[model samples]
Target: MSRNLDLDLIRTFVAVADSGSMTVAANLLHMTQGAVSQQVKRLEDVLDCLLFVRKTRKLELSREGEAFLVKARQLLRLNDEIWADMTGQPLRGALRVGVPYDLVTRLAPAMKAFAEAHPHVDISLVCAASPELSDAVDSGHVDVSLLEYVASEAAGEVVGIEPLVWVNGRGSDAWRKRPLPLSMVDEHCAFRQVVLGALADKGIAWRTVFESGNIEATAATVRAGLAITAWLASTVPVGVEMLTPEATGLPALPAFAICLRFPATVQPAAQEFARYARESMANEPGTRRAQLANIA
Candidate 1:
């Protein structure tokens, strides 16, 4: 119950454990690597144990750290429950949520409906890339998140998976003859590697006409006929035509997973809200229409 063992240190500990590196953990926590390391060192000093061992290229958790992870997560969960109860209103604590821009279009109506149903529960949504979203959930900045991840031991339940397609501007038929200029998100994106690997296997020539971490920018470049881009078929922007192999001669890419994860501290209301959101998306129409009405 000491102030030194507060939730901030616990969160830093969790982020370091999950990311296995101080730098990546820093990016996830929105802090500097030195700050994160200093905090971790401070926590270790208070606990009187080293939580991690610095390996050649990785941060390996000590046995003590491994053992502490379970309890640490539980402590974080209990903290959230306490905050929810002591706020003096019925389930009136904030629910931090992490979601992608495309997924948000689909989640809006469901969240609105949930807000209407539970007026007391405050919700805070942090829009970010899939990597950041997953890291935020792992760090306990958010109780639950929707992320784009492949099947892994770390991944949780699958919310949805959509096939990817090459899309180009409506009037640009340049891709109809040969491999084309490509606009894409940065290497940190889960789908970026998938698309590049597919093109590599097919011996398709491509140049990086534009690269950005922002999905909106990539979509805009694709719309402007600047370059060809790959995106989830369901989330493809309007006014872009899907290029076909027969018509544009590009091989098809496989679908990617969109996963949902819950932090160890997720409450009953958050759980209920996640369920309602999923159910709402199940019945909604395609992403294009859902986005236009802002009711996804």
Candidate 2:
């Protein structure tokens, strides 16, 4: 006797594997937890194996579930590929993309050009911090993202890198002093670690006088001469001067990387958008200038 399995059951199974919780998977699939549980049970019955083990606060994957997840991801990917091929659509659909705030000024214009080139596609641009943006992409809330690549979770190809320079209000000499008072993003920021890490490595003293999570506020604090702070060269607000050792006597951070991430299941139009991002960023004058300035 042959048994037929439901595709919805398989989808629920994959969502549960990805989310690690029935409630979260239910939210993703827009189904109730009971429905999700029933589907998982149906899936298990068809496969005749236990899939997940519920612990105190989380669901742990059994060895069988672990193997099943790999297969589920492959099946979903194959299905998407097959569906896309069969339809032969131009990928005209709403695409939501997550980008870090700083890239608005640096890369938004190029993205606008991409949108103009593909007028049929509706695009939604969400500006967020790197970690938040990455989370959005990982959770399938956004099609693609541009974010920083820290030593932790350094998974994607390097898309852009620039020196993180100390910037201060024009004519401010605070950066020239030892144990600088700094303006910085709050604890949740990706660059907060980068800044603190670099200072700790050099054994430099710093006091965080301002901890606004907003980049604009951090830059404004620096511009008002309240504190000196590190900034990516491309996104540094105009009129604030980059601190050189001649001016600040502090060693410069030579390079920090930015990256683009998309699911292995990203759609064709999304891939087209990513290609545009890669190509436009490759020709970015700001990035080029920063690299040259760092060398010189």
Candidate 3:
């Protein structure tokens, strides 16, 4: 006979892994620390293995636990998707969301699914660079904002990570120039400073060949073999080819994070959207973990 695994236990385990602290997980789950511990212990007992390494204050998943996490997230995503489809809680309100251009496509499916589920709710998407998105969040202009940052500096609930890579038009050797031609969307583009800093550290000479607030213009320039550009690997334009470190001899770029931010007082719709965002990104390639995206 097969015994069913409890979703509650799997959820608790994932929260602990995402948080790296039972205390933080407890807060996110709105449970007492001891209660969270009991849930974790119960799950481990059922599985017959230690799920966490408790040798230090900093919590880590055991090897078996790591393998279990991927499946757990998939389970939770399916559950949540089904729950939303069934109109759980039936939320109805207006929600404004700030999204960086890079994540606009990735975020679309969740938004569509949510809108279909809650026809009464209104969602307005504000497309902007990450900096502007943060300002929107701080000013309460948007109920939720998705921002990108150098992974080390990312704040709030980080849902996804992808490499920052150099790209050139197909068959273009634009990156080989003595003073490389770079295409940038704007000064405020999330990749700006880190990309420059990476090149500087390698002593690579570079000059801007194109700069625009419109990404289409920047992509057009790069696609025409006019310049090389840096992008999150997943978001690189179709006509460009990723310039590998081995091929370009350029310094390796740091990975960037897709993070969710909300005002201190989060709207209910914002919380729901955050959950869908986290689930959607978890299903995407290169995201580190499945998360709850709790507004902390």
Candidate 4:
């Protein structure tokens, strides 16, 4: 006999995987923590495998669980699309979304969900620096923009808050150099100015050894132990580990608001995209997704 995977169980698993804590996932899912734990257990039993390895502070995916996550996401996406098709009028249109290069991957879940739900809507993703994205939003070239901005400077709805963090290769001592070596994006990157200002205010000497528009290049430099880099905590790549400010003697960096921007007269498709993006990104740790009012 074949067993079908329960999407509810899979959703709970994905929520826990994203937040790393059942309590946070519970809050996001509006379920009790114990209930969330039970669902995970039930899923594991159904699969006849352990899905998570519980650490002292968080739940991590075992190798088997990690493999299942991708399939789980696909199943949910298809399910969501089918449900949307059955329940609502399919809106036909196109949407251009502006996103920072570092955030493109972060937008994947929202993008896929949105695309699946609105199959008739075409989406064009414009990857650029935050500042450029801001310009695109202002000029009306982009229908919606996800931005990284100083809290006080955010002109759009603040959807989430993400603290900046220092990251280097696992076990790399590159941060110990007197004049710290650095890998970063160019002036167009929104983080460049904020990160440099923090270091300067700390009276720390630093030098930029690598600078490019490619985020992967910067991540590779840090992963190779050639230099250290800073990024929003959630967007840090896999090979690098975030260094504790206290342990590394690095200055604490400021948090940036993840803002959503679009003109007041945007199309129904744009508004629809915003709603999906907001809901999808809400569960991320430190984000205030629950507090956002419905987009006007």
Task: Specify the highest-TM-score model's number.
Answer: 3
User: What C-alpha lDDT values do all the predictions have?
Assistant: 0.73, 0.73, 0.80, 0.78
Q: Give me the displacement of residue 184 in model 2, in angstroms.
A: 1.9
- lDDT per residue for candidate 2 within 59-176, as digits (tens), equals 8778998788767755655666678679877668888888777676766766888788788889988888787876786577888777765533443446777667778899887675
> Considering only N, C-alpha and C atoms within 3 Å, which residue pairs clash in candidate 2?
none
Q: Candidate 3: list runs displaced more than 4 Å.
A: 1-89, 285-296
Model 1 poorest ten-residue lDDT run: 287-296
Candidate 4 lands at a TM-score of 0.65
TM-scores, all candidates, are: 0.63, 0.65, 0.66, 0.65
For residues 142-198, what per-residue lDDT tens digits would candidate 4 score against the true structure? 888898987656545567776777888998999999699989866688888888888
Residue 31 local lDDT, model 4: 83
Roughly what TM-score does model 1 have, to 2 decimal places? 0.63
Clashes of each: 2, 0, 0, 0
- Ten contiguous residues minimizing lDDT sum, candidate 4: 287-296
- Give candidate 1 misplaced runs (Cα > 4 Å): 1-89, 151-154, 174-179, 286-296
Q: Give the total clashing residue pairs for model 4.
A: 0
After TM-score superposition, the amount by which residue 243's alpha carbon in candidate 2 deviates from its true location, in angstroms, is: 1.8
Supply the TM-score for candidate 3.
Answer: 0.66
User: lDDT (0-100) at residue 277 of candidate 1?
Assistant: 67
Runs of candidate 2 with Cα error greater than 4 angstroms are: 1-88, 150-153, 177-179, 245-247, 286-291
Error of 1 at 286 (Å): 6.4
